[model samples]
Target: MGQGQPRRHHQVPQFYLRGFADDSDRVKVVRFGEQPRTFVTSVKNVAVEANFYKVDWLDAVREDLAEKLIGKVEDAAVEPLRLLAQHGELTVQQRGDVATWVVLQYLRGRGKRVDSVGLQKLMLRADLALGGKQRLASRLGLDDSAEVDALWDSIVVRGELADPPTMRYSHLRTMFSSTISKVAAAYVQAHWQVVTFQRRRLFTSDQPVCLWRAPDDDPGVGLLTADAVSIPLNHTTGLVIFPQIPSGITGESAPTTQYHRWFLAHTWMSAEELLILHPDDELPDWLPAYREARLGTLGLPDIQQFIDIGEAWRTHQDRSQPAAEVSF
Candidate 1:
C-alpha cells in the first residue's frame, strides 16, 4: 500500500466450468488428466446447493381453501375484492370500488392505526375487506373520508359479518417471507446470467509470480498470480455481490424496476424483502436491524456445516490435479 499511486487491479484468473455427462443423473465434473489443460466444460450432474428461499403458510390452509386463495390479495378479509378486481370477474363499478378498497385495506392491515379495535375488525370484514363502503361511496363519486366512514358503518350493520380472531407478528412474518421469496424467485427466473469456473498450471520458464507488467519492463513474460474462480470456497471470499445491474437491453424492453429485479435474482434477498431497500448506498440502512431482529431469532446450534467447505473444495481440486508433471 503506497500513496500517490492508484489501487492495483489484480488480474482475475480464468477457469472452465468443466463436467462430464453422468449416465444416470447426467452431471458434468471439472476434472483432471484431460487432453486440453485449460478448457471449458458443462457440469450436468452437479448437485446445486439449494439456497434456502423458504417461506410459511403453504400448509396452514386446506386444499380447496388454498386454491380459492391463490393469487388472492392475501389479507383475510380484503382478499375477495382483489381476486374479483384482478381477474376481471367483477362489474365496472364493483371493480373500481374494490380496487380502491384493496389499496386502503393494505395500508391499514399493518394495524398501525388501530384505535378502535372493534371498528377496525368491522372495516376488515365489510368496508375495507369487502369494499362495502367503496361501493356506496363510489356511487356519488365522493372521495371524502366522512362519507366513506358513514358508508362503512352502514355496511357492517347491514351485512352482520363476524369479526376475525386476534393474530400476532408470527402470522405476518410467514406471510412476509412467502410474499418476498415468490417475487425473488420470479426475478431470478427471468435474469440472463453466467457463472464461470477456472483452474491453475505451471509456467513455461519457471518465472516467479508477477501481477502486472510495468511500463519499463522486459518483453519476456513472468509468472502471474490471479484471482482464480472455481477454487475451493476457503481460498477466497465466497461472495458474488451484484453491486450494480446493467441497464438497457437489445431486444425486449426491461422492467421499470429492472435493477430491483436483478438484485433479487442475484442476491439472497427478494424484492419485497427489500421494500425499503437502499442498494446504491455503501451500507444498507436496515442491515443492523435485519440481522439483529431476524438472525437472532433463528437460534444457531453446535457444529456448523459449512465451516471449511470452500477450503476443502479448493484442496480437493488441487489434489486431483497432478502438480505439473514437470514444474520447469
Candidate 2:
C-alpha cells in the first residue's frame, strides 16, 4: 500500500432492532415532537430468562427489517443462511470488562451469557500474557518488586504492563458503539417505501428525497452519499414516560408502563480489510478474560440427552427397514 493510498471503506448492509412499548407501539402515526428525557431509564426492559429483553419498536421497524432479514433471495438454502445471519447476533453486551472481553459470540448470540471473570481469562492465547513481568519475575529467581520493575523497562516501553496484575487483558476486538443502529438505518433506507404491512406504511416525511440524493453534497449534513455510496445512520431515540401517578391513575389503577429506546448510531466496520477485532485471537489488556466454549453445550436437553439421542439415531440409520429393535 502506498503512503497516500486511501483506506477502502465497505458499503456493507446493516440492521438493528429498536423497541417501543407494546401498548403505545400499537398505534400507527407517531407524533415527532414528544419529549423523552425521563423515559429512557424508567421504562427499561426488565431481565428475561436471566437476560435483558427490551421491547423493539417492532411495528415501526418491521417493514424495513423484514426485507433486510430475508433479502431478495429465492433459493431456500441461501434464505436460511441470511435468516441465520440476521438472527445470528441479536444481542451484544460486554461479556466482561471492555479490557477483558475476548469473544464476539457471547455478546452477539441469540441468547448471551452475562459477563464473568472466568470467561475473561479462558479464551486468550497463552503468549501475550505468558512470560510477562509477573511470570518472568517468578520464573527467573527474582521475588522482589523492584527487581521485576527494573527488568520491565523494555516491556513497559512497548506498552505491555499490568502492575499488580489488574486488567492484564486488552480488548483485541474493535467495537463500534453504533453498530446496531446503523443496521437499522440501512434497512430503512433500502426498503422503506417498497415494503409495508397490515395496511400500514413506514414513516417518511414529505421532505424531498431527490435533494437528499444530490451531488456536490452539503458537507454540513455530516452524512454523505455518492449515488452508489451512502453513509446513513440510525440515531433514533424513541421512548415514553409514565409518572407513577399520571392524571387519570388512582391507587386502584396500575402504574403505566413506559418504553425506552436505546439511542444508537449505525455502527459497522468501514474497513473490513484489516480490522483485527476477534475476541479470542488477542489477549485483553486484563489477564483474566479468556475461555473457549467446548462444542458439547450446543445440543438441546444437555449432553446426556444428546448422547442418548445420537446413539438412537445411529441405530436407526443402520437399519435396513423400519425396525422392531430400534431403541438400541
Give the best candidate by lDDT: 1
Off by over 4 Å in 1: 1-124, 127-167, 170-177, 191-328
Residue 34 error, candidate 2, Å? 40
lDDT of 1 at 149: 78
Question: Model 2, stretches more than 4 Å misplaced?
Answer: 1-42, 47-120, 123-173, 177-195, 199-328
Model 2, residue 80: distance off in Å is: 29
Write the residue-wise lDDT of candidate 2 on 77-102 in tens digits: 23222322222221112101110111
- Model 2's alpha-carbon lDDT is 0.23
- Model 2 / residue 322 / CA error / Å: 64
On the 0 to 100 scale, the lDDT of residue 39 in model 2 is 23
